[model samples]
Each structure stands twice: as C-alpha cells, then as structure tokens.
Target: MKIRTRLSLLFTLITAIILLLFATAIYYSAAKDREKEFYSLLKKEAYTKANLFFDADITQKTLQDIYKNNRKILNEVEVAIYDTRSNLLYHDAVDIDMVKETPEMLQSIHEKGEISFYQGDWQVIGVRYPFQNEYYLITATAYDEYGYTKLNNLLNSSILIFILAILVIFFTGIYFSKKTFDPVRDMIKKAKIISASRLDLRLPLKDNKDELAELTNTFNEMLTRLENSFEAQKLFVSNTSHELRTPLTRLLTELELSEKKQLTNDEYASLIHNLTTDVQQLIRLSNSLLDLARANYDRSKITFKTVRIDEILLDARHQVQKLNPQYKVNICFDMETEDDSDISIEGNEYLLQVAFANLFENGCKFSDNLQSQVVITNKEKKIQLTFSDSGIGISEKDLKKIFDPFFRGDNKYFTEGNGIGLSLTKKIIEIHNGSITAQSELNHGTTFIIELPI
Candidate 1:
C-alpha cells in the first residue's frame, strides 16, 4: 500500500479502538449509577411502608388504602413485612411474589442493617425495622423499566456515534497526509524533468525550515558538483584533442613529404630525427593526460600510506635533475624537529611524488638560473613546503588560471611544456587533502606554497 493509505488506516484503527474503550466505560458507569439510584429508591419505599404499617395514628385499613393508591406511582413494586419469628405480618402485593421470602433471608436482614440483591430483572432491597420493642423484616422488589430503556438508547446512540467518528477520522487522516506529502510529489516531478542539459534548474524551496527543504538544498548542491564535473570533462576532451592533433599532423606531413621526394641520406636522417622528436612530444602529452585522469579518481580507490613529505620532495628533486641535468634543486628545513611524524603525511606516495615533481620542474624550467629552492616547515600538525624560483614570473591575470588545464601563460614561449603539469598537480594535492597556492610578481619570479595535514 501507499504510505498515505497505510497511515490513514493506522490512524483510524487507533482512534476507533480508543473510542470503543471510552464508550464502553461511559456506558458501564451509567448502568452502575442507574442501578445504585434505583436501589436507593427501593430502600426508601420499604422504610416508608414499614413506618406506616406500625404507626400508632394510622389504622391497618388506611395503610392498605395508601399503598393501593400509590401502586401506579411505584411501577411493579412489591413490598412485604415479616416478624422476627419468620411469620408474615404485612404484604402490599399478595397476588404476585416478586421476591421469595425465606427464614434465611429474614435472618440475613436481621444481621445486616440493610441489604440489596437482584431477583431476575427485579432489584430487591431488605431492611430491618424496630417498632415497640420488636424488630420486623421488610423487603421491597421492583424493576427499573425506564432506566433500562434509557440505557438501551444510550448504547445504540454510542455505537452510531462511534461508527461515524471512525469514518470521519479515516478520511481526515487521508486529507492531512496528502497535504503533508504534496511538496514531495512536486519535488519528484521537478527532478524528473531535470536532465543533463538542464542542470541549472533547481527545486523550489518552501518558507518553512523542514527536512524537505534541507533535502532540496542537498540535491541542489549535488547538481552543482555534477554540472562542474561535466564542464571540466568537456574542456579536458577538447584540449586533449587539440594537443594530440598538432604532433600527429606534423608527423603525418613529414612522412608524406619524405615518401614523395628523392632525398639525400643526411636529409633522410634529419627527417627521421625530426619525426622522432614529434613522437616523443606525443608520448609526453599522452603520459601527462593519463596522470591527470588518474589524479581525478576517487581517493578511496587509491592506495594511501604513511610516507614522509621530505622524502617525496627529495625524490622529486632527484628525478627532475636526472631528466634535466642543467636544472638545480636545493632543499632545506626551516625549523628542526625531533618528531619523525612532523614531516610525515598519509597519502598515495606515487601521486605525491608526481605533484612535487611538477612543482620542481616548473620552478627550474621557468627560472633564469635554471634552479629551484624548496623550504619545508612543520607547524600545527601540518607540513608546509615552498618552491621558489627567480624566473620570468607570471602576470597577475595569468596566475589565477595557472591551475587550469591547458592554460599556458605569457611565459609559455620561455619554456616547452604541454600546460597539463600544474593542473594535474592541483588535482593530486586535492586528492591528498592538501592545498596549493602561488604568489608571484612580474620579473620577481614565482613561489608555490603547499600545505598537507600530517
């Protein structure tokens, strides 16, 4: 069943049970009150009859006449009086015995001041009266016809009201439940219409601060991330295509020219050399692209270990120098620390090395002295590293786009690079829960600062 229907049924069932129990209690209390009131009336009638029967001013005939006259007022009432010896003394109704009089019954009445009991549908009351040094037993019995009729009417009315209330509650529950989930229904409809092309669309927000509003906010945030990722993926593909086409087109053109011409051996050798250079450029671009893609992967899929940041930096410096022997890298500690963990961080060693290597290569390749200087500092549970070079620095406008993929600045002519290094470095650092920022002025060179939690 749908949630609305199920909630409605559950709500109705619970209310119905409570109403049933309450109605039953009210009915039971009313019945008990009626029985108690009727018994009191019977007891009063019996005592009055006894007083009239033993009165010194009234004769026996007159007492009988009074009872006969009051017979219609007390409906179906029977009264009897007996001496202590169990001998009948007076009886208002001689034709019908509403209650059976026994010696045990008289003895009970004498022991107790008064007693009340039931005989079939009749309510019976027994009283002990003292007159002229002798005690008499008086018993009265009557049926509460009016009270029973009223009780039956109340039970029927209660059942009718209970059924009506249950129906009203069932429908009311449905109405309220529908009202509550209307916003959710609208949200689902809006979400269905939001395709990849329409990522800018957002769910409507309500004024009240509720869970549904919070859910909408979370969904909008997720959509924002997805939209950014899609845009990045598109840009990456376009750049990769453009970068690969240049080298491939040059290789194809050179090969075609060599095939169409009758060249000297030296010309052929130079042509081959040129082709080799183009192929090597293609290989480097492909590798950078692969590294960038790898860096964008979820961190959970990457292997992480406790590796020293200082060790990774040293390794990166060595690798850069091995590739370009003219490049010089100097590494030094800003502050001495006895704790080994001060320079240690939890990260993927390979990715960290890749990021550091890019920074080192950029620093040396862009500097006029062909050198990079790295300073490491450990403070506040973080490892901070600065890579500074005295090179033709980036302009203010170009610095902002340094980490963008395929974004080469005005210094592009000063060095041969695919422009993927800084972008890939940024992704790798982010994956390791680190931050990288650059500060530079034209002619003053540039410095890249990185912080990683230890």
Candidate 2:
C-alpha cells in the first residue's frame, strides 16, 4: 500500500478505538443513572404503602383505596410487605409474576437496614420499616423499560457518531499526507526533464530551509560538476586529435613524396632520417598525453605519505638532466630554519616528481639548451620553488593560455613540444592543494613559481 493510504488507515483505526472507549463510558454512565432513578421511584412507592398500612384509623378497604388513589405508579412496579415473623402483609397491584423474597434476603435487609440487587431482569430493593414499635420488611421489584429503551437509542447513536468520526479522520490524514509529499513529486517531475544536453537546468528550491530544499541544493551542485567534467572531456578530445594529426600528416606526406620519385642514397637517407624524427616526435606526444590522463586520477586512490620537498626537487633535476645532458639545472636552498622536518608534506611521491620534472623540462626547453636556476624557500609552513630560465620568453597574451592544453606561446613556434607538459603540471599541483604561477618577458627570460603547503 502507498504511504498515504497506510497513514490514513492508521489514523482512522486509532480514532475509532478512542471513540469506542468514549462511547462505552458515556453509555455505561447513562445506564447507571437510569438504574438509580428507577430504584428511587420503587423505594418511594414502598414508603407510601407502609404509611397507609400502619395508620390505626384506616380500614383495609380504605387503605387499599387510598393506596390506589395517592400512590404514583411506575412500569412493572411490584411491592411486597412482611411482618416481624416473615408473614406476607401487603402486595403491590402488579399483574406480572413478582420476584419472591427469601428469608435469608430479609435477614440481610434487617441487619443492613436496606439492600438492592438484581433478580434476573428485575431490579429488587428490600427495606426495614419500623411500625408500631415492630420491624417490618418492605421489598420492591421492577424492570425499567423506559431506561432500557433510552440505552438502546444511545448505543445506536454512538455507533453512528463513531463511524462519522472515523471517516473524517481518514480523509484528513490523506489530505495532509499528500501535502507532505507534494515537494518530492515535483522534484521527480523536474528531474525527468533534465538530460546531458540540458545540464544547465536546476531544480527549484524553497527558502524554507527544510530537507527538500537541502536535497535540491545538493542536486544542483552535482549538475554543476557534471557540466564542468563534460566541458573538460570535450576540450581534451579536441586537443589530442589535433596534436596527433599533425605528426601523422607529416609522416604520410614524406612517405608519399618518396614513393612518387626515385632519389639518390643521401636523399633516401635524409628521407629516412626525417621519417624517424616524425615517429620519435609522435612517441613523445603520446607519452605526454598519457601523463596528462594519469594526472587526472582522484588523489584519494593514490598512495600518499610524508615526503621531503627538497628530495623531490633533486630527483626531478636529476631526471631532467638525464634526458637532456647539455641543459644545466642549478638548485639552491634558501631557508631561515636549520630543521629540515618543516620542509616535509603529505603527497604521492611519483606524481609530485612528475609535476616537478615537467617544470624543470619546461625551463630547460625554453632557455635554448642553456642553463636554468631553481631556488627553494621556506616560509610559515609553506615551500616556494622558483624556476628561472634565460631564453626566448612568452608574449604577454600567450602567457594567459600557457597552462591550457596544446596551447603553445606565439613566440615559441620552433619549440619541440606538444604544450601538454605545463597543463599536466598545473593539474598535479592543484590536486596536491598547491598553486603554480609564471612571469615572463619575451626574449629576456621566464620564471615559474610554485607554492606547496607542508
């Protein structure tokens, strides 16, 4: 069953039980009051009969006539009188088979003064009356027909009221349940219209600061992240295709030219050398692309530990020099503290090395096979590394796009790179909660600065 239906039914059931209890209490109280009133009337009649029977001047016929005239009657009323020896003295003018009083009951009434109880459907009351200095027993019995009818009517009315109350409670529960879940329904409806092509769409949020509003806010954040990821994937695919197409096109053109004409041994050798260069260039581009992809992995999935920043720098400088033996990378440390423990940070060692290696390679590559200087400084739990290169530097406009994938500067047309190294380095730094910035003057020099928290 739906939650609304279940809630409604539960509400109705609970209300019905309470109503039943209330009705029962009311009905029982009314019945008790009716019984009390009937007993009072029977006792009144018995008293009147006792007064007339004890009057010395009244004859038996006169007593009966006075009793017939002065006594107020009730339905199914019956009265009996007994002498001190338990002999029958007076009987009421009742046509029904009256309930008999036992000697044991009269003995109890004599001792207790008065007693009332039920004899089957008849209500019986026994009283001790003193007349002429002798004790007499007066007993009355009756079935309260009017009170029974009233009780029956009350029971029927209570059942009707109980049913009506349950119906009201059930519908009220349903109405409120629908109102409570209306926001969820709206969210589902709006979510159905949202797709990849419509990622800019957002769910409506109320200012009520309730749970539903919180859910809507969370969904909107998720949509924003998905849109950013989609845009990044599109840019990556476009740049990779463009960068791969260039080297492949060059190789195909050179091969086609050689096939169309015969050439001398030196010309053939030159063509072969050019072909080998193109292949090697393609290999370098592929490796750089792979590194860029690997850098995008979530940092949580990679192994992390405390590592010394100075060791990473030394290792990166060694690797860069190994690749390009003629390039000089000078490292210098500038610290105010003698303790090297302050220079340690938590990170994946391999990825941190890759970021530093990219920066060193960029400095050496841009400085025209000349020397590059790397200076490290420590300040307030942070490490700052600066790479200074003296070569053809970047233009002011191209500097802004330098960290973008496949974005080479306008002044570095002859540089041997696919321009993915700096972007990959920037991504790695960001994942480690660090920052990288650059300052350059065309044909003068370029310097890259990196700051990492220790």
Highest TM-score model number: 1
Model 1 misses residue 412 by how many Å? Answer: 2.6
Number of colliding residue pairs in each model: 0, 0
**Ten-residue segment with the worst summed lDDT in candidate 2?**
65-74
lDDT of 1 at 70: 71
Query: Which stretches of candidate 2 lie above 4 Å from their native place?
Result: 1-166, 176-186, 204-208, 336-341, 390-400, 411-414, 439-447
TM of each candidate vs. truth: 0.82, 0.67
By lDDT, the best candidate is 1
lDDT of 2 by residue, 1-454 (tens): 9877898898889888888898999999998998899889889877876786776556666655554554456464567788767787876553443667678888888899999999887788888999868999999887887889999999999889888888888888899988987888898899999998998888998897988888899999999999888877888899889888988999999999999999899999999999998998899889888888888888787777899988998898898888788878888987656676778888878888888888787777777767888888986678888888888888899999999887887755657788788899999889889999999998888999988898
lDDT (tens digit, per residue) of candidate 1 on 1-454: 9888999999999999999999999999999999999999998888887877777577666776666777667675678999989999888767667788999999999999788888998899999988889899999988899999999999999999999999999999999999988988999999999999998898997788899899989998999999899888888899889999999999999999999989999999999999999988999899898899899888899999899888888899888898889999999899888887888988998888888889888988888799898999976888899989998999999999999999998998987888999999999999988899999999888999999998
